[model samples]
Target chain A: MTDVLTAAPDVAEIGRGVLVAVLLAFVAFGAIPVVAGLAQFLLIPMHAVRNHYRETGPYLPNVAVLVPAWNEAAVLTASVDRLMALDYPPDRLRVFVVDDASTDETPAVMASLGERFPGRVVHLRREKGGEGKAHTLNHGLREILADDWMEALLIMDADVIYAPDSLRKMTRHLADPTVGAVTAYIREGSEDAHGLTRFIGFDYLAAQAASRRAQNVAGAMACLAGGAQLHSRENLEAIGGQIDTSSLAEDTVTTFRTQLAGRRVVFEPHARVLAEEPAGIDALWKQRLRWARGNVQITSMYRHLWFRKSVHPGLGGFFFGVFWFAILLLPVAMLLTSIGLVGLYLLDSDLAATVFGAAVFVPVATFVFMITMTISVDPRVGLKVWKEALLFPGVVSFAVLTGATFPMLVPWGGGDSSGWTLFVYSWLVLCVPAAFLVRKLELTRWGHRLAPLGLYLVGFGPMMCAITVDAYVKEYRGAAMTWDKTEKTGRVSV
Target chain B: MSRGRTTTDRATAAIVRSLAARPYRISSPVVLTAAELAARGGVLPVWADPMALADETEADRLRERRLVAGLVVAIAVVVLLWTVRSLLM
Candidate 1:
């Protein structure tokens, strides 16, 4: 093994080429989203300046707010009480608490509220089905849309607490005929929120700010998150008010659909709501898995949307699919590529070492830029917290490995139990497509854990790590769909 | 308080069960605290409209973040590989 550092130049050239290729890829990946996002960001401000908050007309539309709850007995009454206290004109706004056949006293509480608020508060219930939130929401929408006076519907979660003016602020956007849906800024609620919650909270604000701004500029928003999304009754009926029950990311899919129909989905910055954040890692992981899975489902279902070449390709459907696929598959790609590069380098030290410097620089630069941007969005988390967020890539790698190895360990059953697997499978599918499909079939047929072997290797291993980073990035990227549902550790009487 | 369950308690149970069940469904709602509901009802109009307000640089900020994140992931992976090699050798 004569060390002939003689071939160093050749190795350097190859390494340089690899580095350039990687950087170009990274740039290509980052540029589309960045440009599209910036276009929206810049355009919205311009439009706002042009419009100058002029009230086009009076006729404030009536809103039907739907809060779908299950097993939230602990925080229900306070949530309801808060809901009942909304500031919209009683004649214009209606509140519906849809009970998904809770095995608890939720029915009684909803009943009591129905009694107290009468016409203002409507209570509806659903029977158990393999279908998830989509079924319950459809049931509610069918009933609410049946009423002609309800001009729009606000889709909310049980955990979200809307500001007094939130409904009113959200409603005004619908006055513009072009606007089909409106979603609001979600703020972090609890101070004692754990690390997971804090990360999610910071990520939420930053994403809302970015996505809404981007959408506003682009004139085509990606999604109206479930937290506090306001939908025009006309828009809902136009697109079939019943959400896609089969797809996981119904809100996102719906948003895309509305945008496709030539209607705009607005991301309102001023309209704010506070929702729960997951308290622990497990909860956070499961929650994210569901979100990621839902997004994948939507991406798959709307694969056709991406196929249309005429729309703004960068911000258009095609880019969305590519990004979705990349976002999910990238961690694995990174891991595999990194391994390959390193292995090649180790085998040929002079060659690998020569290229390493260039290969690493471009991606790192991009990472720094992303981190700086994320920190700017949520100053509450501060720069230091952003440093923590930087650790996300590592976590994502772990999640990727775990997901790849243990795709089937995820729950396949329908309903509440399915929620867990839905979450897990969502993450797993990103890294392990085959695993995801197998589990999808298994879970679709029955509701149980298939094998802990897949779970141990993928679900709990490097998959965990990959997921951590993915979650953090999603948070910072403002890509996360809902606020973390923080489990209240202390009792506070509101 | 016969401990039968306050409206709040019942509501909490309903919400939890609704989220945890198979269908993950819930009942249509009634306004419980008119005061709170009224307050929420009002604030929405003063602020929430995407078309109405400027994006205020938030989206650009997020795009920059993703760029940075991608870069960081690249570097970290490189560094990690370097560190492990250094240790092993």
Candidate 2:
């Protein structure tokens, strides 16, 4: 075998070609999202220079802000108080709180708010629950539509605390007859947020604020933020006033429908709202599963609409084809690439090392460039909350090590294959919702900074993949639709 | 919150459920073909309206600025990683 390895030059050339081919494939696939993402950096100047912001000098049409609460007793009164304090005409603005049969103090809070605001607030309490948010939203839509005096409908979550000027900022967009819907920028309010929330905060900054700003420059939106969605009366009527209640992502479907009806959806950056997110891993898992499932449902629902120019030129072509593809499938692709690199390493160690350097070079380079660009948008997180970004390299390094060991398993002869298999299997199983588990391990004598790496890998990779996979499984099983609400603590930091 | 269905999704899902739940055993190839057939429409757009963006020179200049910035950062990262690798070695 040694002589054979030293001898055959033709076979060696063939092997080199195969290895190079695999390496290139991995690079090319990884580059798709990177290129698309980097291309948005061109909009930095556009976002800076353009006068996208419009001053609302008395452009507030009679607006009805709809808040759908399931069991949101914690933050209902605070949210209602905030809504009452919006910088719009008190006579023109109305607040509607739909308490979807909450057993909590939500009904009482709504009642109190109703008493406080009197004519300005309408509290509609439904007797039944668990019908999902789309149904609850449709209930609000029906109630609001009955009153023609209301010109624009604002759909917001119970936990969303809009800035005083948020309504006015979002309201000005509807002055442009072409603008159908406007969505506000959502910020995580908790100052003392944990690791997962910090990562998610960074993600929101990059993905939602930065990316959508770029998409807005192109005169389209990937989707509107559900928490602070503002829809014009005419636009709502154009796409059928009723919210469709059989899929996971009502907002995404509505975004597509509005654009298909030839009205632009604006991402109002100035209109900022603070919304609470799942604090723990299990809560985050369930929340993300619903979202991932909703996205899947939208993708399935809009199969005929994707990339179709005649009906939805922007929504079909760019958002669904480019943005959605990158967001949903990139993780799976990266995971596959990781596995492939491992397999390649097992076959040819030298070639694998070279390929590994290339793999590391691409992502790290892209990430650095991206962070540099996106950080300019949110310097606080990019600079101050920088540990997550700093530890990312560690995550990437461990991912490579874990991946290389993966192919060592699979019963293809003996060795430490069993150990490799055990590590991989244990990681996959324990990694999801393992932050608390990891915290305990660290407290016990032997753990170190490796705990942070565990949080990133297990939190970002396995847990995220589990969300999407679970969503797909449920979809395949045709599980009944239920608005599995994320629990809120009413923890709004001023 | 979930449950926001389109008519097409509802219909397609119904058809899939019906076919899968049938007594007759379906071949893998047939099922795959049917699935592909269902996902057939949707044409891509080649030309998108520039959305009232008239200043080509400005866009080009901005693009150049971004390109230069990206190159600088990429170089810095590669250099940083190489230095670490050298130090380790």
Candidate 3:
């Protein structure tokens, strides 16, 4: 009778221990992505204070800009015009348009540039190699890497319209000698007018700004976007020029290689380029599937870098890739499972509301912090981004649908993006449903099987409506890297 | 036969190692020029004919595969446990 009297406190002590452990785990997960934003914010002032590129003007090297194109008639001419109008001296700047046997007006545009620029434009027509963008880029690099005069080469895609001073700003950073490749800020092109486009644009800025800022400070800038990148000839040769074109993500591998070879890469927010983003859900899914699978490919390729000394210096780059894969799977599962657990709790007690409120406070707090830091990057984006951030839960559900549906439809066996059909089908069918089901089950399980009521009436479910509303509200054409060609409104010089 | 072959190979390796370790204070342009000269050399090896080197590369690749396979098995065990828990839940 005496021992039974103190049993309540003993159970309370165990509950406290469990609560502390749960809190600690959630805190760790929340901090990983947030730390990246914090690191970038800290470095911004130091980068300004150091003024690393102050002495960069007088030592400008000859740069060969390679724009490899195939069937990009819609945007090729505007891109070439921007290239021609670059502020660098015509003699020092060499622009090569290697037409990958285009059946479109792209080849004609390249030919026309030759007559207009004379010696400045070099047109290389190559046979259609069924390989991919990476392969074409490698072929172009092979042609020019041996050219002793070309000091540094900027590899750019056809759809990328450079800011006139983009190369000029990027090159100054490269002159620091420690910096290997200077990748410009790639913004969404005007094609991003739809709901999906707006969400992608906002989410992209948040993710890139945070991730790059974090990695740059850690001395492990994982991957440089290939849309616009400046690489040194010597550094290129050190790693043996032109990445394994066979690699699904060539830019990511090259970024890792540059760092492993002891070269510092810094991100310049001022140097920017506008790119074409995917137009519809079909195209967007196809593009993101490539991106997702490519990320998987990279995670596989650089697995050794996670713990091996011989690999890249970025300690958690490979793990972060795994985290991205988890992002596609975890949220929905957690939500639904929590809902189920709550339902079970509600059945036993009248204190259901108290239990639910306590459990949800952690994710809500994390979401608030992410929103606050993102707004600090651009305060004007507060209400606009907040609305979109609110919609993130719904977008996540859609993403789950994308993640699960894609892999089953297009198994990874075909080897990279060359097999476009299977790749498109994977995201549309299997990955998409699988992701949605994860969320539905998580919500249903957590919400006592009233997931519909929970999603609509509860905290996370309302996020879907918020996301759709946010998408429509923020739907303005902006510049972002897209797989499809964008319809141009006006022309501005490079 | 073994003695002569070993002596000749060891001497050659020693000479090659010594040359490689030497600090050649050559500029980027000079090094590139030398590379260009070597490329134009009449006795230059054909691009695909380096069979022995390729064989050595393949052997190294095989070793890498074995190491990766061991790591994969360890990861697979973790995945299996996670899968079981997820399914049961």
Candidate 4:
């Protein structure tokens, strides 16, 4: 009778223990993307130490700036003019505009620029146009390598406007014998940049600029941004003079090759270029899809490079591994955690909410804090970036929606599985796209940022994942490696 | 199959074997960027490829590390669920 009296109370306590343990495991795996921010956090002290670029005067290498153009009459002339104005010596700086049979006035513009600048500008017009950016870049690279005098090569886009001193800063890194390639801070300068651009501009601060700074400490850089990547003659020769046509991510392949060859690829914050991103959601989707696809391609191409002794430890081993496991697996991990929480909720409602809420809030709160720290990389931009924090609610909602998936899924141990629980779980699962239902409201930044919150939900995370999935399937099916270029408007000003 | 095996390979193989023998991180997945921290912490270097053996003594430590981690996770999940069944259900 005494043992029976105590057993009743012990049962309730044990229920709580099971709930606690499962909830603990759910949070542990799910919150990885947020936790990955700690990689930058630890680098705070190291990054705080003053960054000093070497003197620009003596280190300037003869640079052949290659701009591959197709239907770029909109931005080519202004871009060429800006390139001409760059601080490097006129004799040292040669601009090659490889026109891939543009139907527009691009051919005419290229012809006129060549006539005006004479020897300074070279235009190679091709009859066929469908060949990708890599082929056009290769056409220029072949001639450049043949010349042998071109000490350094710059692979830049047609719409980007470079600062007068940008060449000097980017090229200086090549002076170090061990340094193979360098990329600059490519900032969006679109005058009519939609809210998508603002959010992305804010995002690039952490995603590109700040994150690269942290990765720089490990001698790892994930990619040489396509807009303003500079490469040394010898380094190009090591990887073959032409960029790899095997993958969509030519720059990323080059970055990996340089590291594998034991050369450092540096990301210089001081070297900046202004370029335009797609101002509309449709265009942004096309642009980001290509990038998403390319990254997936790079991961496949360099799958052998991860955590290998043959390659350097930085990009190949550590940073690329982080990008693969930490960043890419984010949505899947979060989704699983949500399912686990649902199972726990079936066990006990109040304890489930409390425990699940704790797991969800920590990463959400930590991510917001990470975004704030990332924005501080530029105080002027940082000021406007605080508005992005308002999206914190949307961010929190993301976690909640993720955790609420299959909310009625309780194993119930030996007990009969309840239909009511399954019904509730199915109902809760419908909220996954609930943001779309409210898209018309256009209440806050979601209306203005990236896409309407609903569309962004599909495009940014799930769409990117889907695109990667498709890319792998397509690659396995032997899809053509056509260089699909994102259309750039001439709206940006440096 | 490719080339002559050097002494450096043997030494690295010995070091990796020793490192693998050490204890694993307590609840490593909970730490999120645990791999990043470990890599940044300077304790883990770029080891040889998964397919390559440092020497006959080399245990392919990476495989062992991953195996142990998977087991821990599997055991934890099972124990948690089973305990819940015994205690509550």
- Maximum-TM-score candidate: 2
Model 3 achieves a DockQ score of 0.02
Distance from true location, Cα of A447 in model 3, Å:
29
Error of 2 at A373 (Å): 3.2
| Every model: Cα RMSD to truth | 16.4, 15.1, 18.4, 15.9
* CAPRI tier of model 4: incorrect
TM-score of each predicted structure versus truth: 0.62, 0.73, 0.60, 0.71
Q: With candidate 3 superimposed using the best TM-score fit, by how many Å does residue A55's alpha carbon deviate from the native?
A: 8.4
Query: How do these models rank on TM-score, best leading?
Result: 2, 4, 1, 3
Q: Model 2's chain B TM-score?
A: 0.35
Predicted candidate 3 versus true structure: per-residue lDDT over A1-494, tens digit per residue: 77877897988888866754454454344334334333343343233234334433223467888887777777777887888877554456888877877777877877888888887888887786446777678777888887897888898888888877677667756655566787876765554244445555556555554345444545556668788888878678866897766455678778877766666666655566877775433344345544544555666665545543223325344444433434433433343334433333334322332333343323433443444444444344334555555555454433432332232333442355333422322221233334334335544436435433333223233332223222222232222322333333333223
Give the chain A TM-score for each candidate: 0.70, 0.82, 0.69, 0.81
Q: Which CAPRI level is candidate 1?
A: incorrect
- The residue-by-residue lDDT of candidate 2 on A284-308, one tens digit each, is 7667777888988888887766655
User: Considering lDDT, where higher is better, how would the candidates rank from best to worst?
Assistant: 2, 4, 1, 3
Highest lDDT against the true fold, candidate = 2
Off by over 4 Å in 3: A1-58, A307-312, A315-362, A375-386, A395-494, B1-89
A1-494, model 4: which lDDT tens digit per residue? 99988997898788878766876576567666556665553353244332323311135567899998999999999999999887555567899988888998998898889999989999987788777888888988988899977888999999999987678667655656667788988877777655567666766766676677666766678888988999988789977788888777778788887766656788876667888886655555456656666776776776666665434456545544765566656545655565665766666655655665455434534444455455555556656655553343344345333333323333441244444334333332233344333333343455555345554433233433444444555667777655656677698886
Better of 1 and 3 by lDDT: 1
Better of 1 and 2 by lDDT: 2
Clashing pairs in 4: none
Selected candidate, larger DockQ, 2 vs 3: 2
Ten-residue stretch with the least lDDT total in model 2 chain B: B44-53
